[model samples]
Target: MEQKIEKLSTVKIQKSPDVYKVVDALNRTLKEDDLMFGLALDEDKEKMVFTIYRT
Candidate 1:
């Protein structure tokens, strides 16, 4: 069976951003392997869904 992942929180950031900076910030705020995260962006042809996954 698949396990259910609980959402601790939801946050919004700028689309098509420098992901390294975001990860660095998250790493500082959250402990290693203690959280799950995702990013959202516009799905238009000229836009990109630049996301960085962490846990």
Candidate 2:
């Protein structure tokens, strides 16, 4: 008899402000190939936040 195997995958997501400085900083700090999959800006609070994960 024969068996089958499954492969694994990974993903990353991040959120940040719409400001040029923040975005530029994030880009500069992060790796070139690193992915910026998600983004969210809080205009009311006037702040930039970021979220990153891998799976």
Candidate 3:
């Protein structure tokens, strides 16, 4: 299956072990509002990239 998502915003944040907890919470809390959250590592593999999408 193929799906396309729209990018709303992207931010660089300090890498933290518990960052995913926040992302998961956001997804569970606001999914009904058509918003999605994602977390990933930057190219340097030091900082984390947070992205919000409109689904």
Candidate 4:
């Protein structure tokens, strides 16, 4: 089946050592809902922002 995905929302993540864990959980939740997300890092690489997309 053809899927149409659209940008849903963006969330700013705080800097932390377990940042990967946070992203992983978000990914899992999104996947369960048949959606997807992308991550963007700041210039300093100290901050992360995730954009959630839905189909």
On lDDT, the candidate that comes out on top is 3
Task: List, in order, the clash count of every candidate structure.
Answer: 1, 0, 0, 0
lDDT of each: 0.54, 0.43, 0.96, 0.78
Better of 1 and 2 by lDDT: 1
Over 1-55, each residue of candidate 4 has an lDDT whose tens digit, in order, gives 9879899898777667777776678788779787877777867787888787887
Better of 1 and 2 by TM-score: 1
Query: Candidate 2: where is the Cα deviation over 4 Å?
Result: 1-18, 36-55
Candidate 2 C-alpha lDDT tens digits along 6-48: 3223223233334456545665666364533223455554454
- Model 4 has a clash total of 0
Model 3 misplaced stretches (Cα beyond 4 Å): 1-4
Of the pair 1 and 3, which is ahead by TM-score? 3
For residue 20, what is the lDDT in candidate 4?
Answer: 73
TM-score of every candidate: 0.40, 0.28, 0.90, 0.58
Model 1 scores worst on lDDT over the 10 consecutive residues at 45-54
For residues 1-55, could you state the per-residue lDDT of candidate 1 as single tens digits? 8755566665444554576477667756764666544555555534434344444
Query: Using lDDT as the measure, what is the rank order of every candidate, best first?
Result: 3, 4, 1, 2
Runs off by more than 4 Å, candidate 4: 1-3
Error of 2 at 49 (Å): 14
